[model samples]
Target: MSIKFWRSLPFQTGFSIALGAVLLTLILSIAVYNQTIEKVVTDSNHRISQLISTIERSASIAAYLNNDELALDVTRGLVKNDIVTGVSLRSESGMRIISGSPFNFKEESILHFPLASPFMPDEKTGELFIKPNQQNIDAQAKQMGALLVFTLATHSLMITIFVIFLVQNRLTRHLTDLANTLHKIEPGSAERLQCPTLHRHDEIGLLVRDTNQLLTAVQNTLAGERRLREYTETLEKETRKEAERDPLTNLLNRRAGERAISRALDKADTNNTRCAIMLIDLDRFKPINDTYGHDAGDHTLVTISNRLTDALRKNDIVIRWGGDEFLILVQQGHDDLQISVIADKILATLSVNIDINTSIQESIGASIGISLYPDHGTDPSYLFDLADKAMYHIKRSGRNGYFIHTPSDTA
Candidate 1:
């Protein structure tokens, strides 16, 4: 069990009150029982002493007269009281004049009194022996002990109940209400406690007010954090988009193109499929750039990029590799025919006349080189290199054409 569970105000209050009452009752009961026993024993002893004192004159006369009947009567009278278990009288000559029945001489201490002679004052006659009854004392002590236990138990129960009631009202109820309110409170929400006790000047009220303040602060902090997070996310998206796009063509740049090729290679490896890497280079593009200027060249590249994007499958990715150079990644390419068809479309699209100005018009073409993943090489760098080499081969043979790299071509 958690400490908080056990430390609940109601439970702690009840347990402490109950345990303290029980312990107090136990200690006091034992103390009172012992003290009562001692008092009973002491009073019995005093009573026995007083009874002997009252009968001292009679016992002295009986001893002086050498009267056996009188001594027997004295002993009998003493024994009648339950506290006096046994009694005996002795003469000056060491003769036992009288003794009660069942008298055991070996018992505890025998109360001894000197018998004075009536004829001669200050002269000794004999002694009287009395044995106090222990059983009677124990019986009285037991009775008092039972009564003490009953009294203590009654008081303990009453005190426990009263303490529990007092603590519940004073502390436990308020704490319980506070705990329930806190439990219902959700961080970063508009939820708040409606406790009227918060207006009080007590510590509990202060605590409640402070807790609500803390919650309000937390809600504000969380809301601000959420807004900040949302703004940060929007900015990151824009930044990433700007980083990955070419300024002129608005197509994927070389960095994004590398990432796309890596993703494509991973997909191809997983699906056991092939993809094509096509490198496209414009034919006779330098002459136009030198004649009409770089703005016209930029415009031409943007035009070609749009046409290529429209002509290829939606799954294919086109990137502006560098000035006047473009790269395309074709997904799920089945054969050379699939790759060649897309390359042919790009060449035909670029072959159309582009309007550089109202008074000027120019025509351009693109040479495309294709390489297959796991056919040319599994690595993207190796495949791109093969495609570049094949594009150069096309440029060497003739411009505005496409060629697929093969081992036989190198031979």
Candidate 2:
């Protein structure tokens, strides 16, 4: 048998009950047997008296007639009983007869029955002696004791069997089935435990109902908590996004771009790759704002920002480094030549003409400076400084163009 079966509620309870029943039966049987033996033995005197009374008439006639034949018949009749070992008959005329087993008739154990004359009521005839068969008496008592024990044991066994059956049928079976059903149900399930048909309105039914109510309460609580957690996470993500982005352009701010660039550089170093940091400053932003207004300047900045993002790859980092200045990171193992090609694309994209109104238009241009990773430096501060110096060189030379800050340029 499986360990589960042995460990099950019914099995354990049945085993305990069976063992207890056996023990109870044994105890009760012993008590009943002992008591029966003592009771039968204690009543031996009354039994012997009854036996003597039955043979009294026959014994009296034998003694009065002084007849040896009748006396022999009387002794034979009394000795036929298993409790009588021997009997002696004595007449007043000196007639005597001894019969059955030879036993020393003691005054203590001997039963004396006066054999009176059948016709003369007042006359004392003779005496009858009997030796009580002790072994036979003991045997009878033992027989009665054993019978009582057998009856008690049978009664106890039947009761035990019936009780075990009742317990298994009524309690354990239902409980085990309910447990199995509940085990199959998932913790947050819509399905509920069903009450047993026969046990409706009973304790078992009440238990199932209460348990389902608890499960419903738990599921509802879990659902509410889950929704709360998801809402909290979404709010945190949106807040972080807002903090990381430039308010006007929606591009990554300087600090957030730096963090992202640092992470990318770490990965690039592990992979033995390269990166390009490009810094760009607007060429004629102050003139555009002075010519139109702050509204025109804002429109120009927003347009330029969209142009820069449109010109870069998806993985490239674009940041609003400060007012009229942008920081861009290109980290795809691009060589300096490819980096120069990307810079030309950005310059072309920024030199585009923007529509200020239905009739009026604004021209926005930018000067770009670039630095390569691990060629000039690996540090973000060092690379950014080099890119800024390169951008100033482009500003001094002319606007609307790009310059790569080579290690030789530092010389």
Clashing pairs in 1: none
The ten-residue window of minimal lDDT in model 2 covers: 331-340
- How many backbone clashes are present in model 1? 0
lDDT of 1: 0.85
List ranges where model 1 is wrong by over 4 Å: 1-26, 49-71, 88-97, 101-130, 150-243, 269-274, 332-340, 355-361, 372-383, 393-398, 403-411
- Across residues 150-191, which tens digit of lDDT does each residue of candidate 1 receive? 888998899789989987888788778778878877798898
Return the TM-score for candidate 1, rounded to 2 decimals.
Answer: 0.69
Residue 137, model 2: lDDT of 73
lDDT of 2 at 227: 97
C-alpha root-mean-square deviation, candidate 2: 3.6
Poorest stretch of ten by lDDT in candidate 1:
94-103
* Model 1 error, position 337 (Å): 4.5
**How accurate locally, in lDDT, is each candidate?**
0.85, 0.86
Please provide the root mean square deviation of candidate 1 (C-alpha atoms, Å).
5.5
Candidate 2 lDDT, tens digit per residue, 1-411? Answer: 233878999999999999998998898888888887778766776677788888888888988889889889878988888778888999999987998877666657677778788889789898988887878778888999888888888888898889999998998889988888888878877878888898888999999999899889888988899999999999999999999998899999999999999998888899888888999999989888898898888888889889889888898889999889999998764544388789888888887788887788767788988898878899999999999999999999978888889777753
